[model samples]
Target chain A: AQTVTQSQPEMSVQEAETVTLSCTYDTSESDYYLFWYKQPPSRQMILVIRQEAYKQQNATENRFSVNFQKAAKSFSLKISDSQLGDAAMYFCAYRSRGNDMRFGAGTRLTVKP
Target chain B: DAMVIQNPRYQVTQFGKPVTLSCSQTLNHNVMYWYQQKSSQAPKLLFHYYDKDFNNEADTPDNFQSRRPNTSFCFLDIRSPGLGDAAMYLCATRAGPQETQYFGPGTRLLVL
Candidate 1:
């Protein structure tokens, strides 16, 4: 079974600054995928970024990027130029070479003015 | 527009009462999943359907049941609503097991 853990329960970042949310997982599978999802006050889950384990290069999406450390079982999200819209609960999830996706506890991000 | 849709965004039910939540998808995905999430907690998988075949999580309680009658529709039926069941129910779909899952805006259930 794969388990994901996000140590930070809550995080705050000043608007326009950068913030990183840490996540680590334990999985025996060699091939897998990692993802970051955001849920706002509307309670809608939105995909932020995704990384494939086979790829050594990290994944970057506009203002969001991931530091995917396959060997260390770490995948963290970095939000650059954080905005109010970035204030939401961020979840780190893992999908093994097989398909069942499991999620971490999540970190509630707050962007301060 | 949201590719996945969950109807009755907010529901109010009495204890032991039966409640049903519906999900519809336009993404033409072959897999659909149901998840339960309480306050400040990770979403827990309840069950999922790959086409018409249903797969329930081993730890899922008997109080929760699911059905997918066709390609685009699925339902979550809670036979006996308890206070513990009062939480957001999320529906997700993917083209296949390895594809990214697209989520619908969750339905919030309130048990009284």
Candidate 2:
């Protein structure tokens, strides 16, 4: 069974600073995908970024980027220039071809001004 | 905007009462998923629909049922609500093969 793990239950970052949330997954499949999702107080889950396992290059979207290490099974999210609006619950997810997505326990990010 | 819509953003039901949560999508995605998210925890997949084919998770309680009459709408039925069933019900739509994934704002269910 594939499982995603987010070790950090809560994290904090000063506004304009940077923060990284760690994630790891256990999977035997080489062809897969990883994702970072942000859920604000509205409870709306928004896709932050995505990374394909075959791609050696990490995926970056605006101020969010991922350090995807296939060998170590690590997919960590880096939020640069964090803003107050970045305070939310961040969830790391994994999905393989023709399979449903699995989510981690989630990490609550607090962007302090 | 192509989006997923979940009705009754907040719901309060008595224990043993029957409750239904509805989800509609304008994305025309091939798959629709329902997940239960307890406080501070990951969302657990309850079931999903591929086109009109209903797929329920093996661990899903028999008291929970799902109906997808068409492509744009799906309904989750809880025959007997329990306190443990109280959680945020999230509806997500995806273009098959992980092309795109979007989640509804989510409905918070409160069982009394």
TM-score of 2: 0.97
Model 1 lDDT per residue over B17-112, tens place: 999999999999999999999988889999999899889999999999998989999999999999999999999998965689899999999999
Model 2 C-alpha lDDT per residue in residues B1-112, reported as the tens digit of each score:
6489999899999999999999999988989999998888888999999898888899999999999998999999999999999999999999889575799999999999
- What are the fnat scores of the candidates, in the order listed? 0.88, 0.92
Candidate 2 off by > 4 Å: none
Error of 2 at A55 (Å): 1.3
Per-prediction DockQ comes to 0.81, 0.86
TM-score of chain B of each: 0.97, 0.96
Model 1 alpha-carbon drift over 4 Å, by segment: none
TM-score of 1: 0.98
